[model samples]
Target: MRFIIDVLLTGLAIFLAALILPDSAVSIAGFGWAILAGLIIGFVNATIGTVLRFFTFPLNLLTLGLISFIITVLMVQLTSYFMGSKFDVANFWWAAVFAIIVALIELLLNSIFGSKDRD
Candidate 1:
């Protein structure tokens, strides 16, 4: 049940990112690939992201929340790399924007479905 929810959330996030980032696209054949990519992304974020956030806590504090955006962009890029495709952004700025959009959509969905408290 949790896994299904996670996958759906990830797919939605990837879809939102696709919508917001001009260069990001998933082929129709890539839908399955995108879901797989999302699973790996979610796993990476849950594991490596947690570690990075922990180590960057002081920097995150100093930056007043900007660091989280950077971290998210990095994670998204990492996901693209791992998936063996180009999930392009115009630049860091666009990546940040896409990340923010995905985050917002995920937040709204999670809130509506009550999934935020699971972990």
Candidate 2:
């Protein structure tokens, strides 16, 4: 299904991002851990992340969407937390960088293989 493909793509992106970053910035146990991390990240984002974004909508608008980026950074940290020893981020700034890298990779992957109907 499309959802499965998306998750795999995100997992690949996360693994690639971790490899691209310095060892002190981000670490992953393996591709399997990266995939599990991606699933947890997606779940967290779909649930708690959505609520946070909704409540912070006003602040996000005022900040010209910077708040959204911050929220995304926090989501990356939260994902690391949920992943425990398998996936780790050194600090807030590093997590932000990791998030950016993962997002860019995901963007590139999705553009190449995403459903054609998506607008």
Candidate 3:
């Protein structure tokens, strides 16, 4: 149940981000593609991202956690890699734009739905 909710939130965030970003940010078929890309992004973020954050802890701290934004952009790029035609990002800067939009959308959704206790 919680997993499904999380996926839905990710999907909505991706859909909204695609809409809010510039024409060159990312190209997608539509909502369906957004949902699929979101799933890929979430998967990459959950798995590889955890290990990456752990290894880059020093940089993360040194940058006042700013490395997170770069990691988020990487997540988008990874999603684009796996998705091929379904999704396309212009470049690193565009990926950053998409990441920012996705983060904002996720924040808004999480606020509306409220956070689930980890424990």
In terms of lDDT, which candidate is strongest?
Answer: 2
Candidate 3 local lDDT, 28-117, one digit each (tens): 878778888988887898898888999999999999988877887898898898898779898999998788878888889988887854
Candidate 1 lDDT over 2-44, as tens digits, reads 7788678767776766755555333212446557767766788
After aligning candidate 1 to the native by TM-score, how far in Å is the CA of 96 from where it should be? Answer: 1.2
Residue 97, model 1: Cα distance from true site in angstroms: 1.6
Ranking by lDDT: 2, 3, 1
Model 1 global lDDT (CA atoms, 0 to 1):
0.69
lDDT against true structure, model 2: 0.89
Each candidate structure's TM-score, on Cα atoms with residue i matched to residue i, is 0.74, 0.92, 0.86
Q: 1-119 in candidate 2: lDDT tens per residue?
A: 77778878889999999999998889999998999999988888889889999999999999999988888888889999888889999999999889899989998998899752564
RMSD, every candidate, angstroms: 3.1, 1.7, 2.0
Task: Identify the runs in model 2 with alpha carbons over 4 angstroms from their true place.
Answer: 116-119
lDDT, candidate 2, at 87:
97
Error of 2 at 93 (Å): 0.5
Candidate 1: segments with Cα more than 4 A from true spot? 24-29, 86-90
In model 3, where is the ten-residue run with the lowest total lDDT? 110-119
- Displacement of residue 102 (Cα, Å) in model 2 is 0.8
Clashes of 1: 0
Candidate 1 lDDT at 59 equals: 97
Q: What lDDT score is found at residue 22 in candidate 2?
A: 92
